[model samples]
Target: MCSRDLKTPWIDLNTLMRGQRRVLLRHGERPYQLSITRRGRLILTAADQDTDTAAAAAPPGKARS
Candidate 1:
């Protein structure tokens, strides 16, 4: 299993990735992508790959009042 040091402010991407192709992050209903580049750089992006599905699955109560 992967472990993280909560007391530290940094995240070890290598450990986080764990040989995975990509990592998906979900905030409420929105999804984000984290990936690595060929040049050994980290990339973060808003994963809009499934906008329709996300919108359909989103809870209505999460909307602004």
Candidate 2:
């Protein structure tokens, strides 16, 4: 769905975040959240209120993991 030709598998944080603290991604009936941590790290997880929060770490050197 990306329009620009990507030389490498990389995306600008500013562009992706779009100045928001969190972004929601919908898949069928489930919604996932992409958020910025207090330490300026990135986290992606299921957005269900009752579900446990599991965040995958950002790539090495991208943030303090």
Q: Estimate each model's TM-score.
A: 0.53, 0.51
Worst 10 residues of 2 by lDDT: 52-61
lDDT, candidate 1, 1-65, per-residue tens: 26776876776777877665466677888787666666667677686756443342333223312
Q: In candidate 2, what are the lDDT values of residues 1-65, reduced to their tens digit?
A: 65876765887988976776666666898888787877998878776643332222333224322
Model 2, residue 6: C-alpha shift (Å): 7.7
> Which regions of candidate 1 deviate over 4 angstroms?
1-8, 49-65
How far does residue 23 in candidate 1 sit from its true spot (Å)?
A: 1.2
Q: What is the Cα-based lDDT of residue 51 in candidate 1?
A: 45
